[model samples]
Target chain A: MDKKLEVRDGSVVLKVNPEFYPLDIIYSAAYVFLDKAYVLLDGDLKKEILVKLQPKQKQDLEKLGGEFLNELINYADYKHRAAQTKTIREYLLQRALFTNDPSIIPDDDEEVDYNEILNELEEDDEELDDPEGIAVPWEEKYGQKDEKKD
Target chain B: MKKKIKLVLNKNFYDKKAISQAIKDFEHIAKITILDDEFGIELLQKEPLEEPLKEEFSNYVLGLMKNENII
Candidate 1:
């Protein structure tokens, strides 16, 4: 049940199962929605950094956070929070470029009018404060202990 | 012939709920523990063990597996 996947720096990880794939998938979804370029992080401690996505994108990501929680039993509690934060960063980039309503726009459009959704997209002041993204400190602290190998 | 069955588990399984679930997953499993978090997850071996079975042991184990949806 508690099989460790990787350990590096200050963290030890176990890959039981990913309860919520969409929280992670939303990053790509937002990129599609916003018609923007983005990258996902896999090196070092494992992080996601979005080069661009607007405030509205941030809001949309948070709203989707609940869907991640509801969709899977594995995401019912604290686990959902961390995945949601990473998704939001990427979503922000999608929010930055625009000229018209994205809902009505076709996916083939070369550009998005982020200005139009600027008002529709809510800004999360807390996210701006934490660029690294939000995760409970306990997951870091408890996840670090090297399990006793016998 | 009697054989020993060993099961390795995660530390989180040390928690009551996780432990109960794993034990219920296998009928012939005799012991489960967290020896190595990295590579010991599939350590459980199913084999016959010499032990007196209580009248309701199978039912009790089955019930736990059913509750955890591991059945």
Candidate 2:
């Protein structure tokens, strides 16, 4: 496999293309390296993601690079599985919520009739013409002004 | 000696908040500029910044992206 990493200034820098790995995947992989190394992220977020791993303890840099690559692959796999199970997970969650919550089902087997409540409200036909326009009629105001000018 | 590095990031890859946070972290050491769309950022600092400094700044923004779920 072509190594995606390089050792510079005693720091292991891995350049992973954002197209293949994604920022979220890089974040997940970075979290795993936190305990072992002082990790830094660099590079253009659009094209690539750069991960710099400075070991907290003395260790083989080559081995560390290999380990980081493995961690990244593992996290990417996790992301794939999560996406694959999204629908089933959502369905299970919905089922669990409906089954556990008593509010979804009412007691006394009574069905609330919204139509009856709506009918009880006194109907005012005039309310339908509720004017949102200016109260004064335009013709009344303008016509009077024209008469005064005449 | 002073050095300036210009980086043009993908507009879709970053947001203002994340870029602002990254700039703030380096404000002391570097004069930074990030465009309104966050498609580019410039850094000017006395002496070249070690690779780790750039790496940390990137990670800092990445952490924010993870927290905010922008990425």
Candidate 3:
């Protein structure tokens, strides 16, 4: 393992390579230590990043630095896995949505005219089967009810 | 008697806006001057504080960076 930590008086300095650990990952890892330690960032962002951590309570500086390194690794792994599974995740989401509502995925080369379909249904209404006259209008079925029934 | 301390922060890693906000927040405790990237802070009170002013100031700026989503 490369020596990334340098223990100083009551503090530890970490030298991070931006190529391996991105700037956002470093920031995320550093944010975790803010409550436990006084964190300061320096050095060239493009080339190298220097993180200085001084614990609020009495603690081993080397141990704190090691924890910070682990956090960086954790975030880096998370970012890598997210990127790798992005396509599959999108595919799963589309599959789920299509399953829930098939109409969500439009048919290509087929244009649907809802008004035409409605007109066709109206023209075929007379041929529909209604044995008990269930489809009759309410007023036609019962003749208008006595208006002033007491 | 007044105590003075200096902190040099890198522009690439630290946001100037966050640092400015920190300076404003700690203005009551210390007299701060910004020269380039260096902050010259002179303590106004002689008594020891609950936390060291310099470290607390640095922590406050980092907190602001996180709060402002700069980091």
Candidate 4:
């Protein structure tokens, strides 16, 4: 019943102005509805983008139309956030890759002293530094300990 | 009888893949020639294509162009 959407037969058609709703946003929204409906888009690229939503099953046309509109808004918000965080996301990824990769470690960085590092570890370093912790030896951790050792 | 049908589609509004897909619907009976001109993109239909079918094909392409693929 919405002015922008029309219900016909068992499907819904939406005529969205490309100015308010961009093409990429439409695609992202349609991708979510793809499982429930067969989506088709068309329009004179100049002004509006026409979308035809054909349900793959029996359902209420109005509900689906509402969902599509909501999805468009949701996707648009996501796109805006993504654009805003692009630089921060890139920085985060770069930092993660740098810290986790040994090969890429900077040559100017200070050498890591194992004993000094161990001394600086928290008191629970037994659990932090070793695979099996202070309670168990290599063989015991490997399930080869004597049964009577308990 | 063979005839030529010309349909004007907006250049910025149409998708080539959808047009090709629509063309496939009538591939057995028609030959399609696409051209770009001042009035918009032109789809010249050859081989006895009916007016209604041309309209239907246009609508089909329109729907496809609107639904873009996104990740």
Order the candidates by lDDT, highest first — what do you get? 3, 2, 4, 1
Q: What C-alpha RMSD separates each model from the true structure?
A: 25.9, 18.7, 10.6, 8.1
Predicted candidate 4 versus true structure: per-residue lDDT over A37-73, tens digit per residue = 7676667555778777877678888888889999999
Instruction: Give the docking tier of candidate 4.
Output: incorrect
Model 3, stretches more than 4 Å misplaced? Answer: A85-150, B37-47
Q: Tens digit of lDDT per residue, candidate 4, span B1-71?
A: 55566676544545667677767766765666566542233344455543444555655565555554311
lDDT tens string, model 2, A83-124? 999966865554466458736533442324322332343254
Q: What is the DockQ for all candidates, taken in turn? A: 0.01, 0.14, 0.65, 0.16
The global C-alpha lDDT for each of the candidates, from Candidate 1 onward, is 0.36, 0.70, 0.80, 0.66
Ranking according to DockQ, highest score first: 3, 4, 2, 1
Interface root mean square deviation of every model, in Å? 18.8, 4.5, 1.2, 6.3
User: Per-residue lDDT tens digits of candidate 1, residues B15-58?
Assistant: 34544555555445544444454323322344543432221222
The most accurate candidate by lDDT is: 3
Give the clashing residue pairs of candidate 3, or none: none
Of 1 and 2, the candidate ahead on TM-score is: 2
TM-score of chain A of each: 0.17, 0.64, 0.63, 0.64
**Which 10 residues in a row give candidate 2 chain B its minimum summed lDDT?**
B50-59
Pick by lDDT: 1 or 3, better one: 3
For model 2, report DockQ.
0.14
